[model samples]
Target chain A: MGMLIIIDQPPYGTWAGREALDMAFALAAFDQPTSLLFTGAGVNWLRKAQDTADIEQKSLEKNLAAAPIFGIEAILADRTACQRYNLNSEAMIDGVQLTNASADLLGQYSQTAFAG
Target chain B: MNQLHTLHILNKTPDHPRFSECLGTLGPDDAVALTENGVLGLVASKALGLVQTYALESDLSARGLSDDNLEAATIDYSELVNLTLQAERVISW
Candidate 1:
């Protein structure tokens, strides 16, 4: 009912998707309805077994696990994008709903912003 | 002016996967606006001739690209927002 934040970049390579996640968090914090859509390479952010301990970065999996608690509306992943990356529902962090990031999906939101 | 279907605001470099993905989603009535590193698409893609494309003038200038020889038009910041206003939807890739 508010805005859709699209993440099309893969995690860890650049901070774009991560920053987009921050924006989503901030939006949630302010009680602004926000949802996240992971498309293209951004689908990688949904993978469940990311071990970033060596990379010394915050785990997106862990971060996303806390998304709903922060009041985020939805955690959406593009079906095609997830299929291309070979991520099934079991391999993804829980609570992710698969949907096409089509014009219809975007039309539901008042704003759609891309991250990186 | 006719209402455009979607305005693709791309800022990725040509080599980025999203760059190709963005181009692939273009419809006949869609437009593309290249900004930031996406301006490099003006050099990388000679195949955008069919689409109504625009590059941010400052971004193109910053990259040493002149729209005079390019297939797309160049617009200023205000015109960029106007282009967004003119379109039915926008996808910032």
Candidate 2:
């Protein structure tokens, strides 16, 4: 893989996670291989049924649903983090693959970056 | 602008790992400029005195934090910009 962008922060609190998502899509637009690993509080991004209207923000759930369409390779959530956030397959959006979020997982990519 | 070798601009809250990660990399010539939620670090620890720390005055006031009794010097946006310009290496964490 060309690069792995690790998103460790939860959505909406800051622009970091959203900026990272945009970076991933920008890379995909150029046909660069990009994967995203949602670990720590970032696993909240994959949880389904986010209602962002009250927050006056775009729904990241809706945005993430378009990842595959953008040619972004994979959406990996840390298994432990998922459990901590109580996000089971049923509670999360479709197409998210769970992994250990280990150092070995990071080694698969030649380059790795933490999302802002 | 201070004569610093490196300037670290941090915006993460104290609870975030990047906060300490930024602190861990500080060299003798390096200084840290805290902005956004990073200004909260001043309330989180006194050990932050180890580094030459500067907190964004605007952010601190917005968060209802008073830097008068805090360990960090309060700076404005222009000073933060100058810090980035002055340092040979700059990192935003």
Candidate 3:
């Protein structure tokens, strides 16, 4: 069974979300099956276009795009959250699946993690 | 009577010392939900792996955060209430 890493915070405001991503990648690198689930403001990381130059922070899109190479294949977002923020597949970086946010959906995982 | 699971509600950032102190007290059968600013702790520590963790949807929106990047399940107020009802005890930190 794979581990689910749920991120709910936006990037750049604090290093927490980005750090969480790092942790996920670390787990994946160690050969642990890992999946990323984004909802709420965390979806912002998947925006197709982001301007981080003003903040002097490197864009997270490139790292996110490279997630597959690190063995993270299943990336999902909450459908309601995506709709609330007006984010669709076209507006997001490649490889994100939108899913219905239901208790049953979450129950599918044997272990769950939260890093906002 | 069978003992019910403890529901721990954390409402502070992970850096807060209480966050870890509070987490240290949880048992394997307990459940945890992060609300208010406590949601920040999700990334603050790997201790969350000790128990199932959940995040509040409204709080995340208020903070301009989406679950898109979060590692916690997003639940609404109704779900929160349900969780509370299912637990044998509730504690907030």
Candidate 4:
């Protein structure tokens, strides 16, 4: 069964990104199929320009990059959310897919994890 | 077997209340995990009595809180990992 991850936290300034990465890593480590869906403020984590060095927070882009490498087959971000937040597909990390909000994608998952 | 619903709440601000509302949608046997800024809600022991609750110990400690301050049950990362396996469906909001 597929596991759905809803990330509502942004990349920097909080533990949300790290927690999401941890969960993703765990799912990948176990060879479980996992999908990530970015919603609410969490869509900002996909912004390509994130630089946490000035704030001393660890960069999560590496984790984002590893998603595809780890066999996570799908990465989705809310299209309306991205537009509302002034984000573009260009802003996201490579390999992330953009999709409008729909229940079909979510309904397929047997489990969903909300990582804020 | 019944599909378990596990809700992981990460909201911290009491004023912005959706987690509590989401609780109403929970089945009686569902599990709730308080992590990140959501630890604040873990202190309302009277409120969480009816539900199966868990707080991330590392998060609590990072916030300078101990088990003494938590109203719900607290568990380690391993426990949280175990819960994920035990639960048939894990939902986070």
iRMS values for every prediction: 13.9, 10.1, 9.5, 11.1
lDDT of 1 by residue, B47-73 (tens): 566789998776554333442377789
- Model 1's alpha-carbon lDDT is 0.80
Q: Each candidate: what lDDT? A: 0.80, 0.80, 0.75, 0.67
lDDT of 3 at A2: 75
Q: Can you write out model 4's per-residue Cα lDDT over A1-116, one digit (the tens) per residue? A: 68988887655447866788788878978999988888765766676644444334555666677788887878899887777555666546787788865788778889887886
lDDT of 1 at B49: 68
Off by over 4 Å in 2: B1-93
What DockQ does each listed candidate score?
Answer: 0.02, 0.03, 0.03, 0.02
For candidate 4, the docking band is: incorrect
DockQ of 4: 0.02
Name the 10 consecutive residues with the lowest summed lDDT in model 3 chain A: A48-57
Docking class of 3: incorrect
Residue ranges of candidate 1 with Cα displaced over 4 Å: B1-93
| Tens digit of per-residue lDDT, candidate 4, span B1-93 | 345566555444222367567566667778788775565454332455566778877655443344244556777778888888888777766
Candidate 3 iRMSD, 1 decimal: 9.5
DockQ of 3: 0.03
